[model samples]
Target: MATSVNRSCLTYLLHLAQDNLDFRLPEIKALLALRGKSFHPSGDFQEKTPFWCLDGLAEEDVRGVMARSVCAKSAFELWGHGQTHSELRTSLLNYPSENMSPFMHKDSTYRINVYTFNKTLEFPDRIKRIDAMDYLPFEGTVSLKSPQHIFCLLEDYGTDPNDIPEHPNYIYFGRWIADGQRELIRSHSVKNRHFIGNTSMDAGLSFIMANHAKVNENDLVFDPFVGTGSLLVACSHFRAYVCGTDIDYNTIHGRGRSSRKNQKWRGPDENIRANLRQYGTEEMYIDVMISDASKPVWREAPLFDAIITDPPYGIRESTRRTGSHKDVTKHADGIYLESHVPVSQAYHLSDIFTDLLNFSAHHLVVGGRLVYWLPVYRPEYSEETVPLHPCLRILSNCEQTLSSHTSRRLITMEKIRKPEELDGLAQFADGRFSPYQGHNAFREKYFSGLNKRCIKEDNKAVVNGQ
Candidate 1:
């Protein structure tokens, strides 16, 4: 049996994970946007808070959001909420009889659970809290082992550990709906993955990036700086056709030293395609190639539905691209050998982003997304440092702190217009479209900080020994 669904207006509660606080809002909004809807909060909501009460959503809409959200832990149909226990009782009393009657039938089986945030309670204390909810006319028989209906009494004790409140700051009672796909983190852990590399992305963040890109079935996703195809693995899980290009021939061919401990060399079939096969998404594997990002090989047409990549940060991998100032030795008729290995030159951080934005502007379908990481020297970073293009609009930028002084931001941009003939050349001529000067010096700043840390550690060790 189902109650009348007011599709346009209903309140739902989302219990989000505490970590990745910066990514929660964008993830939810992106998911909602996929459904042709927008996020509408009912109360004074804080983005960092664990609980968010959203209006303008039905149970199905909440379930849909949870289906793709890694930041959300669970969601529920909000029956009632209040600032205090007495207020909660009054709120519960005001809930419509018809709305509360469905799950409280005399013949139904039900259970009530007590959950507290930022505080722990004894078993008896938890029992007492559940007993206090007896004021609700739950005519159903209690079932501890297996319940037909599960209701939760959630209490918020505030986020501070030092100043614990004796009473909850807020309370919510709701019917448990669905849980997010957070298990994907543990299941797709890089430590247990079949093929990985020195800078293989963590599985959780890869899924986050995929979600931010709004990748869906049959979508063609490309990673320009694919190292061991971590982003491709994440996209393939969503049933997207995945392909990539990397400057490192060894990475493209999977014919080099192993990244795993105790392994001398990479084994046969140890490649990106094999990774998809291991996860049973081999059919989604498009071909990967050895190519420089600076000199793209794709035709001048909108091809990729989404471009998701993590360009080298010069920490774990050397950032180099093919070509040198020295003239190439020419054979008869100015011919170069097919097997010739061109000398690689330092690919500046600024040029990498400029070329990427230009390539995405030309290759991405309108409304398609481009998601990539931008390494930052924390002190010098600002909104201006992010690369820009006239045809692409920046959607969201979330930072993941790596150290005290270094962080990498996940920048998501959506292509809004087709590239004009001048679009490619405009980025070079226009100073506004160019990357901020600070970004150009990231490589130098990164090493300076690293060297300082090493020196500080050495000094600390010497003093401790003395």
Candidate 2:
């Protein structure tokens, strides 16, 4: 009863990686939501900082989040924290004895680690910092090799690197729980993957998107513009059943020219399924087909648990769908030879998002999520520019800057209710709701200083080659 009482009052501290400052909070919150918990910060929360103190979470909850997060480095059961060492000592001494006794018993073995953020410490200085903690009642044996329990003393010298302070701005001491999945970023890097494409999503961002979608084991996830199956690979890592559709027949069949260097053509067995096999998740692979996103192929029912994709922005890859504007007289008897091929025309950016939201509203289960990327021209971008639908509610919008004037926002939305006739008509009810209307216009804005005609011709040649 005493242990439970002490644990309930305890606050946990998270040591996060400094990169991707905008994404860490949502990732942690979504992971906590999976375990039926809410984010409760203990103090003034600063999103850009490396340390976050959270309240109302058990050790198991912390461990669960650490197991999956790539943005966080480690989590700790915070014992004490303060702006100065003297204050920290007072806080530590004031902590309940019952909470510390369990891990500090004389029969146990433990290790202490000193971590400094935005600063470096010499070996002797690190040892001095550890020695300064002699006031704590640590009766356990010190084992540096393999300890049964680990504790950490973390110091934050502030985020600015140029101005070095004589003392740390903040300090925290806690019992370490678990480290996050940062290793996955390195292990699944696109440079090392067996199959890849020019616009393959980065490994870290792929996992981050999966988390934002709340992907889980046994869930059905779909990607509309699944180039090289990078997003599928991330979902499969989380044990979700993955499938996708792409308009590019060459990509779907894994044929034609290769995206890899020093390779002329793709080899047999060099496809999405093989990529999953390389990651030991081949069983999660459902299928990848050659189909246009502008057209509907699925039945009229809620099927997917999540819809996650990265649509082409006409910057690195051309956006084309199955259709032609030129009037074509029907063949005699409406029959064509087997050698005939379907013609493709430019797919507008606005129409792509309109069809996407409508498709998601009809195809995603209630409470399901839809995650995708929206390219934006920085000067004109605003919340109103995001595409909207009646059945879907906006959850998060995180930006990844590509250039001085261009960025892509990762937009996540949830299906609140089933679609209705009235709902479809009311999608643009908001006067401010405006979607991207043309790929050429966006491309022109993206490449304002360059020769527009030459760029368009170059893009046409590249598409023709593919």
Candidate 2 lDDT over residue span 1-466, tens digit each: 9799779767999999988777888889889998899999988888889999999988899998988899999999999999999999999999999999989999999999999998899999999999999999999999999999999999999999999798999999999999999999999999999888899999999999999999999999999999899999999999999999999888888998998899999999879999999999999999999899999899999999999999998888998888889987768989978676678898889888988999999999999999999988888887888888888999889988877777889999999999988765574676544454543377779878346656888999999995
Pairs clashing within candidate 2:
none
Q: Pick the candidate with the highest TM-score.
A: 1
Cα RMSD for candidates in order: 2.0, 5.2
Locate the minimum summed-lDDT window of 10 residues in model 2: 431-440
Local error of candidate 1 at 338, Å? Answer: 5.4
What local lDDT does model 1 show for residue 88?
A: 90
lDDT score for residue 240 of model 1: 96
Error of 1 at 413 (Å): 0.6
RMSD (Cα, Å) of model 2: 5.2
Off by over 4 Å in 1: 1-8, 331-338, 425-430, 461-465
Among these predictions, the greatest lDDT belongs to 2
